[model samples]
Target chain A: MRAAIPTLFILVLMILAVSLLGVFGSPLLLRVVIGAMINLVVVIGLSIFIGNSGVLSFGHASFAAIGAYSAAWFTLPITMKKIFLPSLPAFVLSTQVGLAGGAAIGAVTAAITAAVIGVVIVRLSGIAASIATLAWLAIVHSVFSNAEALTKGTSSLVGLPIETNLFVATSAALLALVVAFVFRFSRYGLMLQASREDEAAALASGIPVRQLRLFAFVVSAAVVAIAGVLKGHFLGILAVGQFYLEFTFLSLAMLVLGGMRSLSGAVVGTFAVAAIGEILRILSSGFEIFGVEVIAMPGLREIGLAIMMLLILLVRPMGITNGRELTLPWKRKAANELPITNDQIG
Target chain B: MNFALQTAIDALSVGSIYALSALGIGLLFGIMRLINFAQSEFVTIGIYILMLSAGVWFPLAALAAICVVVVLALVVERMAFRPIRTADPATLLVTSFAVSYLLQYSLVLIFGARPIGLDILPELARPIVMGSVRVPRIDIATIGATIVLLSAFALFLRKTRIGIEMRAAAVDFRMARLLGIRANRVIAVAFAMSGLLAAVVAILFAARTGVAAPTIGLELALVGFVATVIGGMGSLVGAVFGGLAVGVVTVLLQAFLPPELRAYREAFVYIVVIAVLVLRPQGLFRGAAARERV
Candidate 1:
């Protein structure tokens, strides 16, 4: 558990910085930081499974979708539900819970969905497994977008209480960080990392690859689900498209940019991408920097970010941190303790 | 009988387009173990070229599109991929995704995100009536194009030295390299072939949809990726079969499911995909190349 200290300390400091920004920054900045925090939660959740198991998942956002919709189902006012989702089941129509209760419901729903779906998913590996997860995302998107009564189909489900303030988002991020950190050092995590390095060897050593992958899948899904609930509440609305391709790509890019093999990579990657994205967004709006007028072009932001990501990957293929956790210099080479190497980072 | 014929033709047309795209993905996967998500961008560029060169003679315009896309594919390989050619499969995939995003937004910058109609191949829109069934000419063209391409590709693989070398490289790159097969040349040839296939898909797709957009090829490439996976990665024949299966299932679901559930047709199709994977985790093909060494 002592190994967890440095990782937790670094994460806590990051969270404190965000909290300070929320307290002192302008409302617009507050909004940006809150959105970034939500995305951070999702990326952290993504790294837990993708980093540890070395599997690419394109479907984690589906759990986020599940969480958002279910949270909306449980929390939306009965009057609003009757107007927007008249065909919802009577139980859901009648249900109206507070934000915490709804988040619980959302997380549980996503966890159960993942547990059922992960059986087939964890059995496969490499690109095949990646494609399977993509298929699952499609399945979820199709169902959620088509289930008009439950999800309002393509329309936005509104009236979610805008209760996910900076405090809530920061707390959730902290929780995600703690959960991920704990899981990374757990037995299941170590086994999954072994399998990730060399599946045949890991299996030869009698590691339950499938089971560990399943556990990671479920755990990550729950974390992402919580982020989804946070996002829905933050936006005061839920839309199927919000949890689809764009969100998946953005979160995955952040994880890969930070480094996919370590918790610190996830956190640093999210902050870096979010900060760059914000600066790009501002520049795209025709900001004047250094007395040189930057022309307004909405498309330039995406292109610029994509180019940056490409350049970064070309320069540092393993990511910014290169899969190593950030540890204090004075604590280096403490012989008996885990040194937070790439192999032990996840 | 008429409805059955129409559905069959529809399925065939869609299946052909997907198969063409999947062949591109499978070819690259065969050589580099890289799933080129940017294949979609290649298709999109081809469509854009076709749209812009509308005033030119149709055959010449098509050739131009093919040439441009092939060149673009080669450039992308050298600039974006070749540098990190030895990276792990996941890293390779993420890089391709970045390239795809870059290409897509660049298209958006060139031609705004909004889709524009393309009037190329207007003649293919005409319908041919046969025994109480109306078959669109484009459907026939798509199916014919796919058949010709597949046969020609098979012949090339069987009869040519480069094709044989490509096959050997795909089967075992290290051993093939040790045996004097040039890795760079084989990989480049694979990218060129995939580019050619993407070009063909772009024309057919444009003719069918009558529109050009930055996102037109994204969905196509995604379907191709899924088909490549279900067909068994690195197995060319399996990719075709997978595309056919996905297309048929999609058409059948849209035709038969209740209107309320019809919108969930994609869900049903993917459910079948999951089922296929569970039954055969390696995919439908048991190719020696796809099997795990252990």
Candidate 2:
């Protein structure tokens, strides 16, 4: 509980800065920051599970899809449902649960899905588990794509109330950060990390690896699901494809590129990648340098970000933060001055 | 009988391509424990090369594609993979992704996102009609190429010096190195073999589809990865069997499922994958591939 201070402090400063930006900056900048904050929610959720357990899940986004769709299903106007999702069950089609209720539905749906899936997924480890999660993602996406009556098939599920403003997004980000911070320093987190470091040894010491991983999986799923709902309302639309690969890669890239093991890494990586991506998008939108204006490059933003991620990986494979939480000078110990090793970071 | 024949040919041709790609993935996973997601990029580059040289002699175009893919594969191994040789599986997987991301979008930068049509291997489009069934010549060629490649690969692994060293290394990397197997040489050869197979897979894909795009490799590689897992990660025979199994099962589902469920074909396929994993975590093969040590 005490160790949550650093995480809370950092988050407060970040939120304050964002609030100032919202007040003074352009709407586009505010939107970008809010978007980044929504992404921050998902990335922090990923950090909770992937960071602690050392499992590279390619399927967390499926849970996000579940959450986002739930939000849309519950919140979209009944009239819109009649137009777009007439096949929906009468109960779902008739009610507009509003944003808060829809977010609850989203959270519950994602948690239940994760809990059920977590039973089988936690039984496996390493690459097999990775593959299993991918299969999970494929199955979810397939259902979402084909289940027309429910998901509107591949068509965009629109008419979401634009309720996720900066205040909502920032508060959620701060809450997610605190939850992650507490979870990381908790008893289960220690046990999970022990298993991550050496499953055999952890088992020998009486750690229940499966149950621990399941706990982390469910918790992270719930957090990420909330992010998905936030994102759905933020964008004022929900599309199955949006929650699939783009956020999957973006969050994973941020997690790994920032430092997979550290909370600070998650914070830093999300901002770094999001900022770089935002800047690249502006550059690709074409800006005048000195005198002449360069024409916009259609795919330069993604290509440039990919190259930047590669270079960063090449330079710092451990990630930008190198797995250690950021510590202030007065509070930092001499041991912190020593080069941090892999075992010490997460 | 005609339906069976058509489905058999369909399954075999598609399965052969999956088998070839899976073999490439399996070979690298054998030694490095690295699931090279970038293998698909090699296939993409191969198709792109063939597309660019479509007006050239078919054999020349194939040669150039194979050479370019092989060089690119070797470069990926040396530059990205080699440095992370001893890293954890997650790091390796992520780095492979980075390499894949780089190669894939770089192609987008150079070639743009538009799909390019290749007229190379149009002869393979010719069909053979027998009684009530018609099969494309490319189907036969695909099956033939797979059999030839698998056989040749088996012979190389069994009889050739470098191939034996590769096998030895695959079984036990540190022991093989201590036994004087040049790790670098063997790994490079593995990349070369994977690249060569990717090139063939590329031509086959191009012949079948008549178009080349960046995402083609990703589409194929995901299936190949599944096939590799289904066959057992590092086993060659299992990869072939797994690929064929996936192809046959997939086509069978597509052919036989109710129309409403037909569009959910991928869902069914992945469901089966999950079921297989739950039942047999070691895959269909319990062979001597390096299991993650506890």
Which candidate's DockQ is highest? 1
Docking class of 1: medium
lDDT of 2 by residue, A158-270 (tens): 88889998888888888888888888877788788777778889999999999989989998998999999999899888778887755677788888888888788888898
What lDDT does each candidate get?
Answer: 0.88, 0.84
Q: Among these predicted structures, which one has the highest lDDT?
A: 1
lDDT tens digits, residue span B174-236, model 1: 778889988889888999999999999999999999899998998889889888888887788
When summed lDDT is taken over every stretch of 10 residues in candidate 2 chain A, the lowest stretch is: A337-346
lDDT of 2 at A16: 66
Model no. 1, DockQ: 0.57
Candidate 1 has which clashing residue pairs, if any? none
> To one decimal place, how large is model 1's interface RMSD in Å?
4.6
lDDT of model 2 at residue B85? Answer: 73
Candidate 1 off by > 4 Å = A288-292, A330-346
